[model samples]
Target: MTVSHLFMQNYTGPLMIALQYNDLFDLDSISTSTDTDALPNGRAFTFIKAVQTVNERLVEQNKSDCLLFEVILISKECSEEIKMKVDESVKHYGLEIGKFFFCKKEELINTLQSNKVKLFLSTERDDVYEALHTGIPAALLYDQADDHVLNQLKVIFSGDVIGFSEDSLDGLSEFGFSETQIETIKTAKICMKEFAVLIGQMRRRFGQENSPLCTCVLTSWGSRNVCASALKTLREWGLDVDEAFCLAGAPCSPILAVVKPHILWDGGLLNMS
Candidate 1:
């Protein structure tokens, strides 16, 4: 789409987006640096691409006002390391890094309680859930083929979150939040406990072994673009692997509500659709 594409309304000023590091990084190995050479392989490149797509749509939505973004990094640990590594790619892409905070987890809620923060994106977390429940527009990003994150995103972003796939990029071209809509969201109340209970119920219902027995090993890195075929081979062994989910774009809660397979893999399988 071009800048002339028709949109519902216009958005003024630069939109601020919050990116949490813990959700993007491997918590176990804090020393592992990002492989900046190949993109999508690294979280920074994926986020940059999404931002570019959103900005392109922004141009179309508000032609008179140039679309701009201020990205802030949120982290409870390894803030300095994440900033240093991601800055290389961020500068290379010509995007500005607004602020980087590596405070305690509890402090995260207070940090994001700002009028400027239009949206928050991260993997699923209790704090993020609470933020959304309180009316802050947010989206959860997950790479594993599991129902847990997918189920939550369906409820939260129904129309707000950005995904890491090409399809999600196209979806960005179509939607932009309105101030009035955001106001409605602010007053909207979704209890955290309610969602937590739903997720637990889903887990117990679907996140279990359909057959008390199976054998399969699935990788959680990115889209499983690395060493994924091995898992597909296991699908042939009748070890009870779900080939349908092998190449699927993570787990989608909407999909889970429909198709129930005998075997689910990766870390997210424990979450119900």
Candidate 2:
């Protein structure tokens, strides 16, 4: 007998946060203790309080990793005013601005389709329409803003990443985290049996957009060696190294397609080769 799947089975419960090329960036680890040094940073006014609460719960219950920059789509040339506002909000919420890459509109149209990029808060509604027509998830940044492409950012802050989209007011949804809040459960890949169980669960929780569970392998690999090789490769590709990271972790599995993921990484030049 064919079992019909439920309509909201994918996101009916708790939501997940992850990325596609997850290993490329290090996820945030938010500590919400009122006594923690970072608590002051999150005091900035934003709707990220619910996410903060969720992170607190994760730290208490399952030690889940927090997000850094969940990748926001925006104009490369956003206004200074809007940029300051968004930037302050991010810092107030204890979020970091890892890096920004600029893509020309025409170039984007050619590349975005293959990349399966979601249409973002942008100044060009026509481009937004084009992106949406391609079956990508696109949306206007906000209600009022300049119509120019380079002058307006229509900032889409990563803190706006929501775990649940339920009924809301003030244009924000209530966070759905509850006693059943999802957390990253630790499972060792040391043994075949343990490994199989971990993989099975990854399959089950893999596709949902808001799935909170994430898996990563920890290894004793030399950071200097790996980072040096990476620097060489990138430089060889004609890219200058403004910053480098020797992150320690195994290659992680990609997240589901529906929920586009963003990454945040450190800055500074590295000569650890």
Candidate 3:
């Protein structure tokens, strides 16, 4: 089919996209390094192509204005390359590219809110989920065949309060919990117990044992209950950890969420969809 036809088929919402580049995946000319260490990969190229295709499709659909664009620096080097390429490409296409690099998470959120970005695009699912929970429309792109997780995310972005799957529930058992308990946690509306348990476990695993461990909980923005629950749970888990105090009502980056070296626990109840 034609480009417009393809664009029409994929997305119906305004597209707010974040660019990711792994040097291995991006073209050499388009890639630059902002840091001393830069590892290029094939994934960067894949995302670049995806972004171009998506943008082209948006233009074809006459929804180009709906496609907001930004580049998140996964690495210092990768960030610089992305900025250079985005500048060149936008001019070449006569497209108004979104801001170049977001060095801090707060800046990124500000840009999104200021621009009223609707849909987010990135190869990272973790970032997408964070954005979705925060009331932003998101389009996630990941190589892993995580359909179960993706389905949950789709529901969340569509305004669902919680998202879960049996498969995801099953995955949680690794952290310690029976099948029945896992199911219950998945359905929790307020997320009190789950937060407590997650923090508790992390304390025991990291704080008490001195293991090289850190805890990160992705909560819905403005969900005071979830944040409170997470703090309580961690304390009970015996972790002498201070809450780093992630913003409760900010958009999250799905891609960055997964890459961080921490085991994520969904200490919330699973509701029936």
Candidate 4:
């Protein structure tokens, strides 16, 4: 069955709000006034209100269709309370929803394909590319002047990291993120580029050997593009690698290919002894 999935690209603020406050207090809890400090961050609370408004709009627009909303809850606030709140929110709004959480790199791509997600609420350009390349329509969830990658996507509303694109990764002097996010992206990009190079080198070395391990990476479902790009660079470098292969029914699509040769070793880098 060909299912067209629609995912909301999560804005960090609203997502954080949904996790922190919603998990702690729901309509029932809030109605009962049991938790006064339920919402710790005022900004997150405001963002939640805005998100609810958007959800209401979605309900109004698709009144007749069976709306299945898939939310990728990739935040630091992954607690039982957050989970309950996310589930409750969807149920309360009457939306059929599938939710996944990520704190690692291997699950990003897997989730995208499994969901068959057509639209996104996450503004991460790399994540957007993961969806786009896999045939999903992605958009920014909020607005910001600093999001250069918005041009690369069908940007909806925008704010914070949800506004950034690959282009936003460049020109750190003028990037919108605070020093912390900028540093985080900078470190991650460096690691990503380095990982790509390492994989490429490994492929080359494996091709020269007759007894290479038939190995496959169980990559993160949500971060498939970064891994894919790294693998692609490996292929381009003339390494015969069986690409990162995922299990059947897994969210991550596994790439199975034979490794090629002609990869030059630099300073005995390929020797694992």
**Most accurate candidate by TM-score:** 1
Using TM-score as the measure, name the better of candidate 1 and candidate 2: 1
Worst 10 residues of 1 by lDDT: 154-163
Candidate 2 yields a Cα-based lDDT of 0.27
lDDT of 4 by residue, 71-111 (tens): 34444334565555545554554432335454435565555
Q: After superposition, how far is residue 1 of candidate 3 from its true place, in Å?
A: 30
Q: What lDDT does the true structure give each of the candidates?
A: 0.40, 0.27, 0.39, 0.32
Better of 2 and 4 by lDDT: 4
lDDT of 1 by residue, 1-273 (tens): 322121212333455667776444344343554555311223333453444444454455556544355678787655555556655545655655688777787777677776356566665544445566666645444334332222221222111111123333233233453443333333322221222222222222223333211122333222443324433322222222332233233545554444322122111122222
Across 9-81, the per-residue lDDT of candidate 3 in tens digits comes to: 4543433444443322344644354433233434334344334443454354454344222333332234555
The TM-score values for the models, in the order shown, are: 0.43, 0.27, 0.33, 0.29
In model 2, residue pairs whose N, Cα or C atoms come closer than 3 Å (at least 3 residues apart or on different chains), thus clashing, are 15-210, 16-210, 16-211, 16-212, 71-262
- Judge candidate 1 at residue 43 and give its lDDT: 34
Model 3 — TM-score against the truth? Answer: 0.33
- RMSD, candidate 1, Å: 17.6
Candidate with better TM-score, 3 vs 4: 3
User: Local error of candidate 1 at 91, Å?
Assistant: 3.0
Q: How many backbone clashes does candidate 4 have?
A: 34
Ranking by lDDT: 1, 3, 4, 2
Model 2 residue 17 lDDT?
Answer: 20
lDDT accuracy of residue 241 in candidate 4 = 46
